[model samples]
Target: MTATTTPNSHTATGERADLLTALAKQRHFLRFTTRDLTDEQAGLRTTASALCLGGLVKHVTSVERIWADFIVDGPSAMPDFTAWTEADLARRADEFRMLPGETLAGVLAEYAEVARRTDDLVTALPDLGATQPLPKAPWFEADAEWSARRVLMHVVAETAQHAGHADIIRESLDGAKSMG
Candidate 1:
């Protein structure tokens, strides 16, 4: 669904606004890391880690989209991590790289679209207290349920963390810093 901005130019208020604002700030920092960089530069790994600026953007976009779906559709929205096939693992790994013909602009555009959808969901959800069962994954506790509020918080945290990673990668690439 297309995202709608409120008359006040804010999609939410109170806690939801706070969450969206935090997410937006992190998204800005993450995108800023790729400013003026060519596709090759964005895809280049500057540090020992495999992460690159464009790849981080793509990965975070996927993460935010998945968690937003989880908020709406429960654990069914997620993949069965325990039963992932080789192809599934390979596909997941591919999320962290800009493969041939994947431009940085394309990645950023997709990320923006996903962010808009997530913001719309946050604004339209009737209850921030709505809960859903967490997907079964090695990293998640078995049978735990998370409220929509918690899910949004997790998204914010993940974006912030990846923005930091992107910042490091950017600095190492060409000595560009997202912030002082």
Candidate 2:
């Protein structure tokens, strides 16, 4: 699709259309960071941080999926963070590292699918004004609420932030840059 093409170009327009466009642009950059790298290269921790290209893909996929679910089903739909066991928490913390058998190709495909679903949700939701209480997470303020639009913006921010992280990781891996 052209840069002018909004998210869900078949139907989206106005602010929602613009938001979709921004989100897509972030996703594009994130994918660009992973291009032309082998599985081994993609999994290399080029920096002191544990982050790798494949892990970033997995992370962004998880973030978008969770927020998209919130946009559709509200706070209760989110995973019960308080209920997570130590092992579950450890696994969640390790999402930014490539696990055995997790190929770059597979992770990228999953990320793309999540992006598509998020775009579809943006197009299908009748009300961007729909609000959901924020879950009781340490990062979130107490009793906070977010509209669907806010959730979309959050996804955009999350994707964009991680894309920058991925760009640095990719550059460190082989001196490749996602931008000119």
Candidate 3:
């Protein structure tokens, strides 16, 4: 099919459109899991896992933003996980919980904004084949490089994985399932 114009006026065809569609579907599932949840419920730990609904959204948002930056700026865009201090670890832990004064609406809004920027980047990037070396981290192989396409796929995977987590958490919280 020829490149089709999206409602947002972005033209994406083939692989780009496929990536956007997959990411959007996963994002919808993730957000849907939080429907009608109050801040208290969104913050509640529904299972043994430390993840909460709002925190999952927050974590996914951070992951998407960081990976999108990596696609644009190479290894320099990521944090030095190998050199994280205790404070850094603590702050990272906080991303999995809803801290005081945080609301579910606020978390979802930030996630929506990040998703918009990522979708925009996918639509605007000239080449999906644009590659960047991976950052130094224990979880990543040294000298590995990822194309923009690969980064986007990773983002979709992460979002989908967390969406599943959110589904379970939501079910535990109130027996509401994203899908029956």
Candidate 4:
């Protein structure tokens, strides 16, 4: 939950260690950016975008959970979008906006659990080179395959990118910057 060492610590010897460490470092930065924010503060739309600290936490958790599922079951394991109801669509859209009754603490706790699950999978995966086709998505190349290692790197990138977004939002909130 806490990243005590640098991201390089993850790569001391093996690729798995490197990926996990990078993921952990990104998670740590994300958490650190939200430190001291109240539920209201975290939910505030400090920037023009719908992004908020709590929402960022929720989004990252969802991303990790889905990707972890893919790691275990391959692309066929992804959710069927055609079957999604209006409520489901709305919920997915709202994943980046902390709504009523949501608390930063609760969101952070959930994210932590998701992170734990991902870490466990990273350790348990028999082979990082095991490949799977990318799920249908606009951002993904059609029918492209991704190795397990690539998926881990993708998760790390997603977390780090969102960490930057959170840092910006937090700075706007109270001038509390995660980086100097």
Task: Score each candidate by Cα lDDT.
Answer: 0.90, 0.87, 0.92, 0.85
Candidate 3: tens digits of C-alpha lDDT, residues 1-180: 445454467888898888988898899999999999889999999899999999999999999999999999988989999999999999999998999999999999999899888888999999999999998899999899999999999999999999999999999998999998
Local error of candidate 1 at residue 163 (angstroms): 0.5
Q: RMSD per prediction, one decimal?
A: 3.4, 2.2, 1.4, 3.9
Rank ordering of all candidates by TM-score, starting from the highest: 3, 1, 2, 4
Candidate with best lDDT: 3
Off by over 4 Å in 4: 1-13, 81-86
For residue 157, model 2's alpha carbon misses the true position, in angstroms, by 0.5
- Give per-residue lDDT, candidate 1, residue 38: 100
| Candidate 2 lDDT over residue span 19-59, tens digit each | 88899889999999989988898889999998898999899
- TM per model? 0.94, 0.93, 0.96, 0.88
Worst 10 residues of 3 by lDDT: 1-10
Error of 2 at 132 (Å): 0.6
Rank order (by lDDT, best first): 3, 1, 2, 4
Model 4 Cα lDDT, one tens digit per residue, 112-149: 88887787777768899999988777668888999889
Off by over 4 Å in 2: 1-9
Q: Give the C-alpha miss distance for residue 104 in model 2, angstroms.
A: 0.9
Best by TM-score: 3
Off by over 4 Å in 3: 1-7
Residue 65 of model 3 has an lDDT of: 95
Candidate 1, residues 1-180, lDDT tens digits: the string is 233353246557777778777888898999999999999999999999988888899999999999999999999999999899999989988899999999999999999899888888888899999999988899999899999999999999999999999999999998989999
